[model samples]
Target: MIIEIAAQGGFGGITAASLRKTIDVSDQPERMRQDLCDAFEPDQLARLASRPCTNCADRMTYRITVTEDRGTHSFTLREAQIPPEMLDLIDQM
Candidate 1:
């Protein structure tokens, strides 16, 4: 599977190259891969309950995309809405 993470709309509403990251699960270490697998299981990802924060100020919005045999899925979340596991993955990226 492939995962892409991008950050946009910060203080100046700009998205620099450094704010985008992508990774293929097959290239990661065993432990990292397992963590991704658990967080991306059909139910876990498909049912993520994050709600965009409309009142955010000077806060970046994150866009997450995952692609696999099933197709591609995307989610846009605010920092406060990101789940811990996904947050860790984002940090590593």
Candidate 2:
């Protein structure tokens, strides 16, 4: 399955409509949400959702909450204020 969560203006902010493309989300949004989750436990998803606010300054924050039989998990991300040293990497995105 391939799910594409697009951002308007080519970057920043995420909305329900932005996630309008869920081709085959067998285990999606969850799997493709970010690369960091790869190192964490499934239950950790919920903790990420409770992090600091990402929607600062009219920017719409995005958070993913997953609920399983045992419990739930989450993840969130706002505009990438990548450090100057990481500017090159941000440009690629």
Candidate 3:
């Protein structure tokens, strides 16, 4: 699986940095693909994806993308809106 975290938009129209990491969970007995799907809640992801951007000053926007054998899911949200599970997943990656 591949996990990508990108930070864009900051104070004064500044461009924030981005990061990407690849994790190989193929060795485990349980499929890593299923684990990733579990980690990404579809409802929450839909909400985040459809939510309008406030364009608040100095606020950092975060975009996370997960790629797996099945497909890819991408979500964009503000820094403060990031879910704990997602954060933990990012840390694991």
Candidate 4:
């Protein structure tokens, strides 16, 4: 599986090309791979993305896309909606 993340709209409301990250779970260690898969399960990610969010100016928004053998899923969510663990995963990628 492959995951792509693009971050936008922070304090500066700007997103450069460098803000994009791509993670190839297949290349990670066995444990890391398992953690990633568990953290980014399609059903869970979709649930988080679909939730309602209140006004949050200057907070970052992230567009996360996951591609698997079956197909792909994409979600755009406010930073506050993302779990802390997932946020760390994005950063480490």
* Top-TM-score structure, candidate number: 4
Worst 10 residues of 2 by lDDT: 81-90
Regions of model 3 farther than 4 Å from truth: 25-37, 41-43, 52-56
Candidate 3 TM-score, C-alpha based: 0.53
- Could you tell which candidate, 3 or 4, scores higher by TM-score? 4
Worst 10 residues of 3 by lDDT: 24-33
What TM-score do all the candidates reach, one by one? 0.74, 0.31, 0.53, 0.87
Give the per-residue lDDT digits (tens) of candidate 2, residues 1-93.
Answer: 232223322333433334322223344356343432332234443344345654355443444443435555544544342223222322332
Worst 10 residues of 1 by lDDT: 9-18
Question: Against the true structure, whose lDDT is highest?
Answer: 4
Residues 5-73, candidate 3: write the lDDT tens digits: 676665677665555555554543475555655665545666766766564467666676766676787
Can you rank all candidates by TM-score, best first? 4, 1, 3, 2
Ranking according to lDDT, highest score first:
4, 1, 3, 2
lDDT of 1: 0.73
Off by over 4 Å in 2: 1-17, 23-42, 63-93
* Cα lDDT of model 1 by residue, 1-93, tens digit: 898887776466555333888889999999999888777654565455354456676666777788889888887667666677777877886
Between which residue pairs do clashes occur in model 3?
none
When 3 and 4 are scored with lDDT, the better candidate is: 4
Q: How does model 1 score by TM-score?
A: 0.74
Model with the higher lDDT, candidate 2 or 3: 3
